[model samples]
Target: MVDGTKKQSLTDNTIGALLMLNASKHGSEIALREKERGIWKETTWAEYAEEVVACAAGLEKIGVKPGKAVLILGDNRARLYGGMLAISMLGAFAMPAYPGATLDELKHFLGEVEIVAAIAEDQEQVDKILELKEAGAKGIDHIIYDEARGLGFYEIDGLMSWDHLIEVGTHDLNEAPGRRDEILHRSKPEDPAIFLHSSGTTGKPKGIVLSQKNVFAAAKNGHDAGAYGEAEEILAYLPMAWVGDYAITVAAALLYRFTVNVPERQETVVRDMREIAPTFYLAAPRSWDQMLTTIQVGMEDSTRLKKWLYHFFMDRAIASETRKLNGKSGGALEPLGRLLGELLVFGPIKDQFGMSRLKNAFTGGEAIGEDTFVFYRALGIKLRQFYGQTEISAISAMQSPNEVRLHTVGKPAPGVEVKIDDSGEILLRSDSVFAGYYNKPEASAEALEDGWLRTGDAGYLEENGQLVVLGRVSEVMYTAGGERYVPNYIENRLKFSPYIKDAAVVGAGLDELTAMVCVDFEAVGHWAEVNGVPYVSYSDLSQRDEVAALLHEAFQRVNKAVTEPLRLQRFVSLPKEFDPDDGEITRTRKLRRKVVQERYADVIAALYDGSKEVHVSAQVTYETGEVGKVERSLPIREV
Candidate 1:
């Protein structure tokens, strides 16, 4: 129990220390599990404690010390978790970089952190690190290779073999049992335990330094709010690089003694999730989008009779949810609709989506269109939206049972005080608030003022006490007519169109809105075949006169949803999806508007002024750096 009277430090009940506590309390509990060689590889709490001690010793022998940082690059695995625990046990914080980061982003990020040591999962990651080091990185001394698979590229001085280092730690721990005690004693609650880099979608990344106190306590609070328990088995399927995943892996699982399940691989997540049937689930909006995609795509391939039946019941279920949305109970038709939907359609859908017995599921990271929320809710899945950021340990507000609402991010989470500033920015003061951004006092001070973290996100709390996050404060643009509108607001509305994969709304200074849309080629291809619309290549399909008219209709629907100035005035369907690799989207699939606008400035300019058809020759770089020109006539549409 933490006392409110005492100021806590990072090492206090830290990743290592918390594991030790759980191990001492329930030594035999399954702490971690992952698939290895077609079999379940699990580590019990007691065993994890022993390994953390060994791993910490190994890191110490290789020069990891308090206040130092160790970069971890890999997928979710038992050894990866152990490596992080080891880093934390050594009183050093762990920084998990997304393995998917671009070479330039990785170089700048790792260099910015000045990471002293790193644990790479495989040779590919090690090669990337070596490349960055060659390109000018400082203070990196150790590179612990987990896979040890083809390590020809690593320097001899920097290399640390995984098993050999583990043996060294084990040998030393056996020689001196008190060494574990000494290492544990060195940890304080305020010590920097982990560095979660900001998304950097908008600007340069800032490392969010989380103390052990902030994480563990926030997890404990979540337990009360969501009712997580020791018996609960959770799938750690999200990226470990994000604080959301780490909160579950380290904070909730370690501190509260919950079982953390790691999927065999990204591809097998659906199968693995069904096998695990996690009691509590957390996902970004895209995960649910993918889940919906899986069902929709699978249904698309099903027999017409089965697809018809599925839609028959699904439509009824949606109507029931719609009634509930209108403050009406699942009355007369609601129960009948639910009963029939569950019996025929939703049961199988939920079973496949692995939502059965899913006590609570969270979807955040962006505004989920209201329809998606209703679909999950009608299926007996309590899908919710939580509001927070990296600086607040990723949870400041969350929707609670039965109190949940559509199109809102819910009320302030327990023990947190939320206020809407006069500027309409969400203000927060909470125990879970992060200490600050690492070594960036000016930015940190700007973020935190008068005991409140000024969440630059704009939103308002409603009469019902639920929150409605509009969009980023910086993202909202005002028209020459003085009408303010958020592009994300328009984009969210656009994504609800099943054929539209993603959209980036443009037009800040001109008369009205415009957008660059990426059609769901796969979905549209199916639509075209079914509707007798002739199409071939993605570029060919996107440029079709019929396709342009369909997109125009979609744009008009969204345009009508907003005011005249806020309505989309013109648009151009992008021949390709917004991709992170190409810098049009962030790693998490959020549109990088600035990047997109800059890259497609000519096209955007042509959309409003010139004719609906324009020829473009784009210089594109391939993955291997081969450059080529892709020439095409991009089709534009006007409202």
Candidate 2:
């Protein structure tokens, strides 16, 4: 338990706390690497620090004072980390805006933030900011572009390239000898450090303001878990826009002297992961889900002999981990059986999934299937469910090695004390927790009560103190028959089927439950290809009768998983997949029911009614500047 204002760890400085250790120990080692044009470019620790110092000096030259809000927009790159550290060096807060933010949303964020200066990924982000200024946004007088690609047209001389700024910094260092100490002196233990926005799960984006004290406290849990250790190389492939990646790559990994590797793009993550074979890894539930899907797909094509061998080893892996979790070796079951399983199933499968070297793995963001949760645990990955929000500085409760339970999200982290309120809402009080939402004191007050943050999620603590998460309280619903249910639970059951990618179930005051389902395109398409089924596009395949029948079977299986009262009566394939850009899903990948309903109003209506097929006539804007109407009778069926 952390009491008083003092952090548990003896470390004081964020940069000096971590990166400095790396530089002195691995002076010439590659501290960070970013892939460009499919080639991984390396920068050593010394080089990285020099650049960070220079960038910090350049930021100071541009009138960025300590505690000023400095916004950053970028992909996973060295500059993003360097820029953040530079801002920290000045005691300024760093706010990272998602690179994927829409033009309107980006403009809104720019206007909302009282930015002293900004560092953009490249010319595209810079151009967008310039366009916003032209359209009359105020308070953005300075800009820094990391990559100088395609900036020739801009005559705005106020902007500077990151490399050029580095040169300017080297010359300025001699003029201000005690600059580092002065910057350090300005930093207080409780000063605001980083600002990150949640996916707006309930509404518009809100900035979570975390002080150095907040994140530093949370880092203790990660550190104690051995997430950061010597000779560990970690893939920083998840969105830099996300706090999960920021915590691992920029905060923990950087502080602990572990090498951080950045992939070129989303598509190259698998390759980058394999090449790195990172000792420690963390991913959202979706990433692990897709990884499981890929493995299952490969097994589907394997010969009977191979498939049997794979399952045999998978069994051994589970047995091994189970014994370990129970604190008993249980004396190896058939020494040769364990060895054979390791060679055939466990070893090869882990290597293929790029987790062979993984000492620990973590999954968060959303609830994973029970099977999905158990599969990794049984494989000895030490992968566990960690629960928290951006408001808690991202870690309140994290599952510890072999202390994991498939049904619950483990116990509270070291510094956190969690309690369930009258409504079964999880409340947390900790130093790791954020102070409040930026610029919304009332909203902050509403979220916080009696010094504890109300986590909106409904759940309870087991006798053993493990936290069992129910769905979000706001997402609960009632039937006209007086039954209460969380749609996420029912939908999760349906989605466990291989054929069903996701389901959106609705039955508030309705006679029976109905659903809109998104098919697993990869699984279904591959099945269709093998079955010799004909299809043109996604919508075409989704509307086919054969696919409808297959999904009907999926619903039947899902029905078997639940009681008759909870079973879905009617279901229809969604014409299109829900996407983050479409506003049907949040960036964190949680579904936005309101957005999905608004976009697919007819589909939900068709499911409820007795209609077998509903003709959908909707106008869609094309990439080539054309407006076209998609008019088709979408098939709807009842199981």
lDDT string for model 2 (1-639, tens) is: 122343645334455434544565667988888888878889998788777777878788887775477878877777878888888767777888777666566666765567777789888788777876788776568888888889866778578788777777777876889874454345665766677886785678887877776777777666664445555688987776688876777666565566888887778889888877888888876678778878877987999998988777776666666666556675535567767776778778889878999987888876666667667876657787788788877878878776877668888877788999898788999877787888889989978998899888889999999998878888778778877778887776677666777778888887788898888787778879888999987778888888988988878877887767777888778766655565667777677888777777887788876787887764554444355666667877888
Residue pairs in clash, model 1: 9-189, 9-190, 10-189, 10-190, 10-191, 11-188, 12-188, 12-189
User: What tens digits encode model 1's per-residue C-alpha lDDT throughout 1-639?
Assistant: 232443543224666566666677778889888876567788898988888788889889878887788888877877777888777766677888887776677766665655788888888778777777887777678888877768755566878777878898988888997888787666767776677888777877787888877877677667666646656788977888888888877777776677888887787888888877888898876567657766877888999998999888887777877887788766566677678778888888877767776887888887776667787887788778887788888777888877777768887777678889888888988777887788889988999998899988899989988889998888888877778888888898888766788998877877766788888887678778777999767778877777777787778888778876687877888776776777777776777778888888788888778776777765565667566666788867776
Which candidate has the highest lDDT of all?
Answer: 1
Error of 1 at 293 (Å): 2.7
lDDT value for model 1: 0.78
Off by over 4 Å in 1: 1-12, 151-155, 333-337, 525-537, 619-621, 625-629
Query: What TM-score would you give candidate 2 relative to the actual structure?
Result: 0.90
TM-score of each candidate structure, all chains considered together: 0.93, 0.90
